[model samples]
Target: MSEIGIRTSGLSPYVALPAELESLENLGISEYQRAAKITDRMRPGIDIPILGLFGEVGSLLAALKKQTRDHPDREKYAASIKEELGDTLWYLANIASRTDQDLDVLAQRTVRSISDWDEVQPNFGTFDDIQSNIKELTQSEFEAILITLAGRVGDLVKDLGSGALTNNRDRLSGHLVDIFGNLLTAADAARISLGEAATANLLKVFSRWPLTEEYPPLIDDGMPDNEQIPRKFEILIEERKINGKIYVQQKLNGVIIGDRLTDNKREKDDFRFHDVFHMSYAVFLGWSPVLRNLLHLKRKSDPIIDENEDGARALLIEEGVSTFIFQRAIDRDFFKGQTQVDYDLLKSIRDFTRGFEVDRCALWQWEKAILEACRIFSELKRYRKGYIAADLISHTLEFRRVPEDRRED
Candidate 1:
């Protein structure tokens, strides 16, 4: 059958070849021979501690880092890094495959053994215990172990401290796989004991905590009668005030929307102005407390907002606008659809304002709204440059038109 026409019946369409076939075919005999030759070239200097390993692996790490950092051309650097990584992996696989081993099987076995070991031994207990274990391994045994590990899994370890230790990808890969394999096993056992202590403490707190009335009033006694209190405080006192006095002043503060004023219609205007002003004060005063409580609650509750909103919103808006423009350009065949936004670029916008504020949820909400607006504008193609410009001008005019009394409130 022709290669294009050949199709197996009753087999998974996706399962054409074993997943390992690519690695095997790519490296195969010729690549293995090349690696063996390289290994032999470095063998003469094997007795020299740093020279043997450094020449073989350290140079590769340094070159990779430099290619990644020094190049202004991102595409070039990315391609170089990818190619180097492939070469490194090919070399590793060749070493393993020729040495009568399967890298995947080795990885699985090592991980399982480490997991079991950790379960049986429990804790390392102290730093001294860890040191003693490290000291116990013989030099030849350590070298053999590292070599075996590197041949199976060297890509996991990160380089550290001036290319002395982790620069040897071959050796580091082996040592890391071994160390982590064992470490994970130990962690599993340790977590069980640690988890018990944590649960007990949580239960103790839950049992002793008191329940209180909801929507309690804020005390107005704290405010001076003649002195003009901030709008936020005033709103908080009005909204949270129960009976003749404020009972829940601290809980009521929030942000003021100075732009959201009512039309001058005596009763409606007075009510709207007072309500918004009081709410704003309440929101401001309660801001920190609410944020603090939200954080505490978040530890036990599901985190709805994971990052800051304002910055994220701006980034999202920027991204949406950029994406819209790019798509339009593409549709118009401006750049022949060559320009593409990468996954990283999109994620960068999404996570732009992470860790900026305490109430990440609030920020996320605002950002989400901005992103939505951008998406709508992009899809509709109604709000192009002209619309954006006009909106900005109108917003400015509206702000400037606000009366001084309303602005003060």
Candidate 2:
């Protein structure tokens, strides 16, 4: 590719630094581009990265709108902005990688857009060196600036498909520099660091979905068998009708565990079957206070563990999470035909579980838990009853046919 961006290499005397301080320092653009590589795509194409760029921009705007409207606490809005903008930056870097372009150099070109014909050489060498150039401003002043940047990015996306810039790498690269310049201005105004966003986005994305499919580690590792989630077990989940009202119940070896459940509403939404979600949480995340309570596995050997991790508060939190997600799932057809869960949904889950042991679980594990739970719940609803075979060790949940002899009439 043609080197159409910017540089100040020979003009600056630079001091190299140690590699171990990577996370603490401003992340380098080239480093982000490399780390932001998307190897987990369902299909390989430029369209994915480009479209992701536009989509993240939209999400950032939506987040800012919420921050502007509901007036959540500063910390909450700060986190929301960081996550949304971080995702936008990830897509930007990934697009550069896919298109054989240099994001850092594009940034450098925008580093000094005016009077560049003769007035060359800035005080900075790398993207991290120019953090001082960023001038902090209030959100009121720069929200419009970011919207403008969004429009510019949207134009670039439009061109990508319209043959105006599809085959022109240099022209597209120049447009990237223009957008980057505006992005820097907006980041400064919003008091956000692109580098910081880059780092945060990495954590969010990889946590949301795995780099590869593998069984994640569970929570209850060394507890006694009685206190621990069973490594593998099956529970018969059935919909039983009594008094012309339907209820969902679980039985293990002809022994009932938890109380029978119903939608507990004027209208039924199959939320009675939400017990499947709690079970999936136990099996996949190894963190479910409701299941612990039901199975008499409250980790009571230690008062602290019992009171905090397996207590009523934890149980309520888990139930609230399941219920909230259930409401969202109702509109989403219980996430039917979805291979991936939304980033914000997973983020909200993490936020709700903050300060809890299960919060330590990765987002991908949560995604798997939700998807698997929904899958089994849909099936159980269709068949009316089935055995939920749960394996904690391998982190698997399967809906199996009830044996003929064991089937309840």
Candidate 3:
């Protein structure tokens, strides 16, 4: 009923579409027109702000201003001036766009040339190595080195918010030149020697290095483990009969003790043996008969009671039945006053219960893993109590549901 492949019946020359040509025509006319329109609209709005800024600047120059000389409020005015300048530039961009001119390309050509000047001029001690070779070079040479570096730095600062150099042409040029200048100056100083060609080679080698890679090691050995390891404690809540009355007594026991080790050999040994120290306890609550038959708790039928029937009897029975069991670990040593614990662990417990009403196995697994990695034996003991409580709360809340009668009421 239908043709199923490329028809190729009306293929034509690859000329620009009529609509595109019309847009280009419109762009040319709009650029100049819009530039004037935008300027007229913005001038009145900016006049008062510009006047206020000038007044402030003049007062600062004369040292007659009440505000602190380098007060942060000056930065606000600077930001405002930049914003106004940006608004003016936006109109200029529209004008350029309408005239079929690419502003970004033009800007790059201009900036790249200026950056060339920045590379050759030198000023002293502007780069990090200036202090080491201060004696070898004259003041003029040092100043020249610094001036070159400063120009390159300015180019970098300009490139920060400029989207025109997406290909990083300006950045690469600026860096190469800056490093070359630094290398030449350093070599002349005799404090640290690196030729211009060698420095260029180094730059080329490092140019492709991923910026997101982990920072180079600051110290020779390794960073010390500063994180406080939590103690693990298994909290067991046992149902018992005392004085002919059924009651639950919650007991906290240290399952895995945590400790901090400075020795690298001991640290590795502790890390390997930490998993074997954990303890687990089953926390029991009331049994449900419906759960035995259904393999889960089922909705109970509501008994329809007459208005005259005892309301207190139903209320007492409902109140006496335990609907939920809660367990939490006392991971912090309150006696020792070590109180910091994983905030996400606590938040996950609350969020998991509130959102899905399911046992937060992911959270428990995370806590267990953390306890396993802990080095402090004492901190590990405290985490066991916390783990037990977290486990009980997560499990008991998962399948717990409200009665339909209660929902209707």
| Candidates' RMSD to native | 22.7, 7.8, 26.1
Q: Give lDDT: candidate 1, residue 81.
A: 32
Summarize candidate 1's per-residue lDDT along 102-202 as a digit string, tens digits: 43433343435544633322211321122112333443443344344344333332333245343354554454345334332322222222122222222
lDDT of 3 by residue, 102-131 (tens): 433332333246545434322122212322
Lowest-sum lDDT 10-residue window in model 1? 390-399
Instruction: Give the candidates in order of TM-score, highest first.
Output: 2, 1, 3
Which residue pairs collide, candidate 2? none
Model 2, 98-180: lDDT tens digits are 77876776677776645672343432244445444555666776688878989988888888888777678877787777777
Highest lDDT against the true fold, candidate: 2
List the global CA lDDT of all models. Answer: 0.29, 0.74, 0.28
The 10 consecutive residues of candidate 3 with the worst lDDT sum are 5-14
The alpha-carbon lDDT assigned to residue 57 of candidate 3 equals 28
Query: What does the lDDT read for residue 377 in candidate 2?
Result: 91
